[model samples]
Target: MATMITDECINCGACEPECPNTAIYQGGVEYDGLDGAKHAALSNDFFYIVPEKCTECVGFFDHEACAAVCPVDCCVPDPNIPESEEVLMTRARQLHPEQAFPEDYPSRFKAGAAAPAASAAPAAAAAPAAPVAAAPAGGATFVQSPLDALADTVPALESWDVPLTCFRCRGEFEVPFQFIKPGTVLHCPHCAGSFVPNTILYRDVAKRVTKFYDSFTAGLDAIRSRHQAEIERFEDQLRQSLQKLKDDVKEASADAALAGAPQKNRGFFG
Candidate 1:
């Protein structure tokens, strides 16, 4: 089933950026599919997801990103638009031609369960028994929130876990998204090393994200250039047509004036 936003949504819009298919839109706003098709807003009072564009994150992630990130738990499956895993995956392929999905691509359907959005890597799923209260030393740039004061009383790395690889150590770990952002360094649970930007993981992510942006801008520029050329061509055609009409009117007026004027008996035939 395609995911749907329930009316319980608070419109915090936390789920918008998390959607891989760009299916979610703000209340009363129109949405453009990845294929450039426009879809009307499903709801004017609450954020909505376009069912046609939603693949339930079948080929992109193990779980639905939008549902996982929704603060109000409003993102839920829509029984009205039920779809099989194969069908969802086919739509995913159509939406993202640049991404490759192997036969063994991750899918919540394959797992038979929708896992947490930011869970640990499959191999380290059970390694978070030791609770950490503060952000680790080294590459970590965890922004302190008001909640930090309660870290000592609360569990560590226990919420909003985001799976990330440590670039320097090549180690994998789960960190909370609340603490990290671009340039915020994170430590690998295995190596305890700080992250650097020169690793293969970083390069791969950078290349994919860069390609997405580059392709988007290039497409827009091509459309803009084509529209500009077409507009100019039509303007030139209309200008020629207007000039011809003006010239015709002027010639007609001159002929009418000559015919209406009395002619002198200079010619014997007149």
Candidate 2:
């Protein structure tokens, strides 16, 4: 059976990107399938899942990714959409042909049991166990080696104190560099404006600085794309307002020109 989002969803939007099939959609958003088919919003107030596209991650993972990451645990199996493992696997194959699934891939109907290890050879079994380097028979205390002690002295990553400025209220704050990560959203305490901190790298620890920056920028881009429709609407409204202002100005200028024109001599005198 395909997974469904329940009414208890808080619309946190954490499950949308985790789906391998892109079956999840935000509230009131139209969904477009890979086959160029469009579907209307299932829910106008809560996040909804497209049952047709949901395969419950049968061929991809042992468990459904949406349910795994949902903070509210609202992504549950749909009782109305009762589909067998075979049907789900077939759909998964159809959706992602490039990824191949084994015949016994873990599914609702299949038990995900590990295959038994092969038996050891008789000759190998007959071989004696290797001798062990034993500690002194006495209750000897173990002492740390020089290299082991040196390993403990390795320096930790130094954290940089970065200053955060609120975009709305212009309030200043300080946060540890480690607190600034990819996709981390912050809110201003004063203005309550949402802000996503930039990825800061004081030192190249684990060579992940560049990767973190790229991921952070990508998340910001995704956020921008998600609200692009709303942005375009605002832009359209601005354009209309500008046009109306221009029209009003033109009418006022025409009225002034007429009012300022000298009237001809009275017709009665002529």
Candidate 3:
């Protein structure tokens, strides 16, 4: 079954670029499919996944990339759009023909089962027996939030925070959201360095900026084309008017000359 975005979505836009089939779209944006069919926005207030294009990461990844990266875990299986593994795999193949899936590629039921549990057995045995170190004297004890504690226990939860390196000081920091605007500059608390957010720099924000520029240039080109056509039409009309005025002047001059010649003949006869 395809994945869906819940209303709890922060509209951070992290899910859009992670989609292999380009199924995710920002609020109010229209999208077109490879088959030349256009789709309207599903939600005007949050990012939404296109049900037709979403394959739940089948033939691509072991798990859904959007779900893996969402800070609030808003991406979930769509209960309304129930689909079988075969249907999802067919859609994946249709969306990406050049890409090939291995026989063991993940499905909704068998996803992540390919990985052996033998390695985790040793870690699980050592986890409970491991002793927690006591805080040093006069040192304050730090408390962790539920999310942070969960991330510590499960390594997979670490995907929620994306690491970003400061361009000025090279200090590394983690941001909760992956999708940030390119124009948004962030100041590093450690080094006081101001730089653009790197999470969406090459992916979402750059693509959005490029699309806006392309659209703006297209609009300008259309206006210029229309103005040029209008100018050419006006020039043609002015040339026709000048020609007509010249012809009228010539006709009047001819009539005046003919009338004077007859008077001259009369004067000569008298």
Candidate 4:
């Protein structure tokens, strides 16, 4: 019965400080332990929720604290990760050993109030997530956070899953990206192109496109240089052959002139 934040988080840092368990963190920040240490191995690309400390306000208040304060209504129950109220109550006791549930009840508590019933209502009304194959046959179907679900519906990005390539360098590659609303510019290491994720797949496509163009241009330059060198060699050989022919012609003319010297003083026929 842990509470979670959806991708709808505006990163306003509003709901972060309000968590009694300090489970909420800014996008890309690390959440280590109850002591609030950073676990560097975990990525900080987006806001994260720590499951260890979340108690769903079982003992603290009648309702979830984060859901109450969240402006975007992104704080909702995680259906994929379901837990019963008994489990939440036990966890609350572990966290605050001295606290007790219904300690101040004056015996006039409602016979069957619906706080527990309403909590399940939101999850019931929400669309069920696509079941993962690895999950147990009857296990809870893990769905993406609310933000992820919304991103999947956004159009104009259907082909984003296609590989990316760089127009300038012809470099091709795949890149990992997290969806950010209004899509932000991405930097590719291969083609060095800056692009936006129009769809979920755009980031990878852009990376691959950059890589493809880079390789293509390099290959083209190599072929051109090789052909240029061959042409220069052929031209050099032709120049050498022409020079030899000119020398031979000059020798033949000299021999002819020497051989006809005896008739030089003769008439026009000589």
lDDT of 2: 0.65
Write the candidate numbers in order of decreasing TM-score. Answer: 1, 3, 2, 4
Candidate 1: regions farther than 4 A off = 33-37, 112-270
- Tell me, by lDDT, which candidate is best: 1
Root-mean-square deviation of every model: 19.7, 25.5, 23.7, 32.5
Error of 4 at 1 (Å): 3.1
Q: In terms of TM-score, how similar is model 1 to the real structure?
A: 0.42
Lowest-sum lDDT 10-residue window in model 2: 116-125
Q: 1-270 in candidate 3: lDDT tens per residue?
A: 578888756665656778888999998988776678787888899899889898888777767777765545667777788888789899999988887788887754573433211111111111121112334467666675443343244222213345678777889886644335466667787798786764546475444433333333333333445557788999999999999999999998877756336554546548
**TM-score for each predicted model, relative to the true structure:** 0.42, 0.41, 0.41, 0.37
Q: Give the TM-score of candidate 4.
A: 0.37
lDDT of 1 by residue, 1-270 (tens): 888887656666667877888888999998896667776777999999999899999888888988776544567788688899899999999888998888888788775666633322111112232223456699688775433343344333325455676666767777653445456566667887775333555556544444333333333333445557788999999999999999999998877747558865687665
Q: Could you give candidate 4's per-residue lDDT for residues 148-197 as a string of tens digits? A: 34334532222333445766676786543233222767556676777665
Error of 3 at 239 (Å): 68
The lDDT of each candidate is: 0.67, 0.65, 0.64, 0.55
> After superposing candidate 2, which stretches have Cα over 4 Å from the reference?
112-270
Report residue 240 deviation for candidate 4 (angstroms): 99
- Number of backbone-clashing residue pairs for each candidate, in the order shown: 2, 0, 0, 32
When summed lDDT is taken over every stretch of 10 residues in candidate 4, the lowest stretch is 123-132
